[model samples]
Target chain A: MLRPWMRCSKNWRAMWNNFKSKFLGTNFKRFMGFVKKEFYHIFRDKRSMFILFGMPIAQILLFGFAITNEIKNVNIGILDKSKDSETIHITNRISSSPYFKIKNIVSSEQQIEAIFKKGQVKAVLVFEKDFGKNLKSTNLANVQIISDATDPNTANTVTNYIQSILQDYQREINLGIPGREPIEVRSRMFYNPELKGVFNFLPGVMTVILMLVSAMMTSISIAREKEQGTMEVLLVSPLKPLQVIIGKVFPYIFLSIINAIVILLLGFVVFGMPVQGSYFLLALETVLFILCALSLGILISIISKTQQTAMMISLMGLMLPIILLSGFIFPVSSMPWPLQAISNIIPAKWYNLILKGVMIKGVGLRFLWKETLILLGMTVFFIVLSIKKYKIRLE
Target chain B: MQALRDITFEVKPGELFGLIGPDGAGKTTLFRILTTLLFADEGTASVAGMDVVGDYRDIRKAVGYMPGRFSLYQDLSVEENLDFFATIFGTTVEENYDLIKDIYIQIEPFKKRRVVALSGGMKQKLALSCALIHKPKVLFLDEPTTGVDPVSRREFWDMLKRLNSTGITVLVSTPYMDEAELCNRIALIQEGELLVVDSPENIVANHTDSLYKVAAKNTYMLIKDLKDFKGNKSVYAFGEFIHYTHSNSDFSEERLGEYLEAKGHEDIKIVKARAGIEDVFMALSEKKGTEV
Candidate 1:
């Protein structure tokens, strides 16, 4: 319906409009410029870079030292009512083993509770008074092991050690009275057969490092703009808030990737921990986790007015949950129902699961689908909340 | 009423305009609205005749805004900072070389140095250079000379005047009344309200009262005694003297000296002095008091 020249002019106008919008519009190139600026801030500060890399290694070593299933030299108080040779032999067997340290030989039942109250002893091995008559007639004797349940893992390990010692002692005594068939129970540890502490701590380190690099660092960067008054300048620019946030987060994403590589390398070289699954899958999951953390950081930045508030929010809101509820060091199944319910809300819990699933179990997408879906949903929810808050502030 | 009450003023091409006020006088609110950082609750504003909200991208490309505080990328080197802002506007320093060359060449030696390490005067110069790097149609500097030394302040104004000669609109805001004289026109604002808008000389020429400077051996005592005098209309302490306007002009300098002598004063001097923008500001603000 239009003349050829007119159509050409219209098309030319269209092309100019398109060029202007694309060149200046919230595009990858423009956003990349903003992101490059953010990287400049991060790379310029050597302290933050050090924290991003060094914290993971330091935390991994700390958690590794703090958590161990192996029981060694557990302090104990023995309450022996009978001073018989058989009872003394049993006490010697218990004390001679590396697992139990005989801190006290209390002669009274009342002292048993005091020893535990003072916190000097973890368990009390009690031998009831019998004069050896019961063992001679019944061919069986009982030794009771009472343990402090404050730390259930320690208590559980100590019980297992004492039981194994008792079984060995019983076998030696039973051999003297032959013609008896003994029933033996065998146990095999699963997942972490050697029960290396580093294995347990590596996943936790990954969760913490991802959170610090992706959430805390990003929040601080955004808040720094608010502090320096540059945020106002950027806001006044033609760039949309989404474009600005994307720019701010892009560099952090790259930094987190580098951080992940460093942590994986440290876990492999220093700790000698292996990633049983595909490295590609681990890297992919790490990137997804970083996205979730960055969304959370943006959400925090939207809520906080200053850098101090952002830092505090990140520390209190993210650190404890990542350590306690992520099933990083503790088994989630062993936790109470209320704690288990609370852990489900923390993103780090899902991330820890994904890390363990991939790095330890070598599972496929089928095993990590639910966790991945939850992380994606959290990312979306955080982003939506931040946008809503930012809009409210703008209004 | 609009949040800014439909502020409508135009800076002639290559002219310098000042919006003078204290904090919370709606000076910044207006600057923000004009810069496209905020939208008014009602009415509209534009820069370079492009609607602030609709044509913000073009407006942004056209204007260089220096906020009330010195806000540049302090982490970046002075040179990198200039280059970054220049690139954002899709131009190079070489393209608009002459625009900011005068200001940039001063700090050019420290170009590779971080902006944070620069002195306040140097920082101000760098900020102005970045604003001018894009060769903007209009430059908005909000309180650009607030905390600088008197020498730096004078130098900054000289730079602004030079920039104005290049046919670029320069709009600045400051609470300093002396700086108001440097502008072609200024709007006096108080408590989110614009009281008066006119040239600095015109505002001073329009001062309603005959002002006099009275001093004695004890200046503070003289000021206190003058306030209590029945004939004294208004008395404010100026440098080295007390500026007093009388209720009536029937009294002469001899009478003022006699009055001060009666009030236990000596070495009295009373002489007529030229009124400044601050005097006019005090008079106009007092006349419009408690209304904002």
Candidate 2:
């Protein structure tokens, strides 16, 4: 009985030897040179070097800290028009709850808007005059909770917290008064109910990693050829334009797939994310995603005159939209109609949806067909544009 | 051979054909078209009898192009860059080992070094090896020696001569006039047009104006005063001397020297000399609207 770690190390060594034998053939010397060259490029560019390694860590930390579903210690402002015992009791209950922290108690309505503008308060709770007297006679009271909806998600969370606090008070009142009929309401959240950010983020990370590695990296590489004057050499060679593009993009595609695998492994082992659908289908989708990204890279390369311009275009034009409109962190369904319409044009939105459906829901082609078709269409469109642009440059 | 606007000249097999021109003289544009990297909107061009556009793929297979800049894969090692170019032609360094053996041997010790880490000369040799890896029939080197040091330029030219001896047609472009003399045939082009195409000696012999090299202690004043001489056709500074060629037969070198001396000039030395290719090029190219 061999030790597990030792056995695994020996197997890894064997696989490594096999891989070397296959690619390196009799020339281990040349293969080492190639790998050294790849390392040189990875290390020479400080920005890309950071993005290659540091970005994932930063994203994880940011998602873990800033973008959270669980709301706690949210700053709330209360306005009590009546200084009665019932009003004070409700105010104490609201403030003492772990979820809400009252930043101020305002006596005037004008102070509510000023406190909100100063960013000291996230939500303002208001109680009307003679609220205890009204509750005693009519057995009903109305209170208003106003939240700053600049960041709609946080605003929504604050409002929900206020509503829950109010309900707790109502429950206490109901217990005191017997024979009171309580209409029961049950709530169920759709899609991701528990709001595990990783569950929502892993697929988004996959899209971004694939796009950055495939599109931005490939475009920069191609534009680099033009900048260095090697493009002319390749163009003048007997190799066709298609052959040249294929050669440039092929290496990146392989590298991006490897990157994708690294991310997926991290997602699985570290985050405990399970792949519900067929691994083969997921791999197929990854390949399709790579093709779409590569075509976009080709298109970017065609439009750019230098590596810098290509990189800027890929960053500002492509990556931003993918991150913002793809419904990776934010739900596209809850966005304004104009924004929803705009999200439809983004390829990452569909890919994110497809990944969620396949990995989380175990849905197959029936659910993913539209996304696949959209990706394919985008690929074709980009390929055609790049080809046309390439021809024009030649002429 | 089909002409670029009635200029018909063919580079003999294994000949070093040079295009000497200034910037914007269309040297790169012409090179691009001939190398199959671009298509000329009009007129016909071919490499080794294969049309540039129709037979582009074959031409690409048959030609080795080294553009103005050192354009090997910089991020890759010298050896990996070499291997990649070799692989592109469906061959390995071992298969065509003899073709780049000389250049490859020079950079062999640095095989493990990344191309971006290599010196300018090393980069040049690597590019040349990558270009010749496919054993091309026609080699188009576009200003390959432009920014390189003098020694490197000489070394590069020597390598080209060596490659040409193997029966590969070499078409080299350069802005340096001295390099034009090294070519078996030279084309002088300016302003997107070919001015003259001929052997260096023949072009020099075709100088239609009389030439004189006049120098004085006050060389600056001599040039300034000589330009104002009534019978002088052209008077321009060449090196430390003023070269004044007369169009009027009545104008004498003695009279010009006398005029310079009267202006308080010293060490006046006037001599009749043979015109170089550059002089002939200047004379011909200066003629506005002169067609090649």
Tell me, by lDDT, which candidate is best.
Answer: 1
- Model 2, residue B17: distance off in Å is 2.0
Q: Would you list the C-alpha lDDT of every candidate in the order shown?
A: 0.82, 0.80
For B1-292, candidate 1 gives per-residue lDDT tens digits of 3445546666677779999988767888888888887877877777888998888777877898898888889788998788767665667679998988888899999989999899999999998998888788999999999899999999999999999988899999998988998999998887676778898889888886888988889888887888888787779987887888877878677787788899888888889988888777776787777344
DockQ of each: 0.40, 0.40
Clash tally for model 2: 3
Query: Cα miss at B126, model 2 (Å)?
Result: 3.0
Candidate 1, residues A173-206: lDDT per residue as tens digits? 7785666537867777667777777777788888
TM-score of chain B of 2: 0.92
Worst lDDT run of 10 residues, candidate 2 chain A, spans A29-38
Candidate 1 lDDT score at position B91: 70
Q: Give the Cα error of residue B106 in candidate 1, in Å.
A: 2.3
